[model samples]
Target: MIATSEISPIATLSMQISAVLVWLGLVFLTSNILHRFKQDPELVRKVVHIGTGNVLLIAWWLHFPTWLCVSAGVTFSAIALASHYISVLPMLNDVGRKTYGIFYYALSITILVALLWDRFPEYAVIGVMVMSWGDGMAALIGKRFGKHTFVHMGNKRSLEGSFAMFVTSAIVMVIILVLANGFRFRDLGVVIPVAAIAAILEAFSPGGTDNISVPLSSAFLSYLLESTL
Candidate 1:
């Protein structure tokens, strides 16, 4: 006869591992399909970025065990680091730049999920949302429509890109706030400043560290200010 406690642990481990595999498999499969079709590398990267960050939403909605989210973050972070040295996922790392954005991105998710999952899951979602949508849009729009350019902290950025980040970040906050707290206009007090700061962090963070800075700052600021309100 087997003990229920033993069975419970086994079940949990199996579920978490399966979820991680599915999540990672989908992202990689999509990226490879896009790569096969000769799609833009940058576009494929952004798709992976946005799609990867969104797993947090599934974790949040399904109330996944904290260990699951943390483990997923750690696993992805390791894979991102490994991909840098190998052509394991060329589409993700062949962006023609020397940046650790993907690694930092996975690290940020790990940190945020570890810190905010139990106490403030909503803030975790907000953080990932801002980073994924805000930063992703900035890169895409910046590359396509960015004409007026200036250098900030050794990174060339356009007014257009910065605006995209700010606007998307603000909208992301508003949606999260309304869903989490039932649509209060006063939430703008938190949204505007957090969005502005997230943009600044994304702009100034060198070597793609904005993946860490923007999301952490956005999540913490949203939590701190929202607590006051």
Candidate 2:
């Protein structure tokens, strides 16, 4: 509710073109890689879930509003969170290769609705975008070259990777905030507290699903910051 003015239709439309480009690049590349590994159709759908979903979902932020943006975001995450506790969690113990992405399908649908709603679509888009790029890159880079991990169980995540994601996400958030004139670096005394919250949200998310939390939380936090400042 802090800064819900609509961005220029042309400018907003521009992110859509980029969204398509992101989709094409992610699909072709991920599909080719999965083919090399001989992944099955189910597995392929899952991969598409992350690579394709991340970009497309994030790209939706080009539009800005109040209810539409926040609702789509809230519902998407609520579904995902629901599925996790109800449908997905029960199956987690089954122990299979393609186990992770199904519950996310529910989450994705919820987020998709959140993104399209006219009232707050822009905020939804920004949150989704940050989670997409920030969380996705963290996983990719961590797997490839994560020498120093912070946690043990998923030694999969690393300090270096998290730092990368935190910085990348915050910088983007700053841009979103800046152009809107909603808030500025100068206003928040120390932006790290806010930025750190964003980073930690992604770092601790289930299966890189911070795509749901990061933006919604950040938007709310940013809104809080806007008023307090």
Candidate 3:
């Protein structure tokens, strides 16, 4: 991990830009391959969605400046919105016309990154991980193996999926906190509740709004819990 004090703004900015381009290219390539093979487009979209969150981990490791992360988020959000309105990038557009979850996803990411990139960088990482691995795996598991279902906001939700989300989010939070701050039994008091709250938020969120709600809820609770403890 780069020391926070050692981060060079100019170098970090260049690295951030390059990382964005590379990540986008990978998403494009993955989308094309999935489309060509007649794979489930929604599955492909989730894979890309989950993978995209790693950029936060990369930035955190490099100790990137808050401005660069926020700028990238804004730029990406604009591109995503443009694609939605004008078909500028069809590969990234995998949802229906009525749902603005993708836009919300970008906006939520921007907000969390901006809010947590400074003193609470670990919260930012936890938020992205919950959104990525927890949410992504839930969809994948729910679609493939879900047998029992419940309704939330007019949408069918699987018990299995919610369980996956809770487990995944909790496990990822523990792992991240351990790596960044060392393992402490006391931290579980914070981690467990944050994971549970985030999972519930994702399960109940209508349309794609979970994209916004899950991370925001997770980050906020994590921040709040950490601050109090």
Task: Give the alpha carbon lDDT tens digit for every residue of 96-205 in model 2.
Answer: 33333444544644554454444444344445556655666666666567798776335346877788777766666666555546665564432455567877876777
The global C-alpha lDDT for each of the candidates, from Candidate 1 onward, is 0.86, 0.54, 0.82
Clash pairs (backbone) in predicted model 3 = none
Range of the 10 consecutive residues with the lowest summed lDDT in candidate 1: 1-10
Model 1 stretches with alpha carbons more than 4 Å out: 1-24
Error of 1 at 179 (Å): 1.8
Give me the runs in candidate 2 sitting further than 4 Å from their true place: 1-102, 105-119, 152-155, 187-191, 206-211
lDDT of 1 by residue, 13-92 (tens): 67656665698689878888998899888889998898888788766765666877888789889988888788767788
Query: Which has the greatest TM-score?
Result: 3
Instruction: Find the 10 residues in a row with the least total lDDT in model 3.
Output: 89-98
- Every model's TM-score: 0.88, 0.56, 0.90
State in Å the error of residue 100, model 1: 1.7
Ranking by lDDT: 1, 3, 2
For all predictions, the C-alpha RMSD in Å is 4.4, 7.5, 2.1
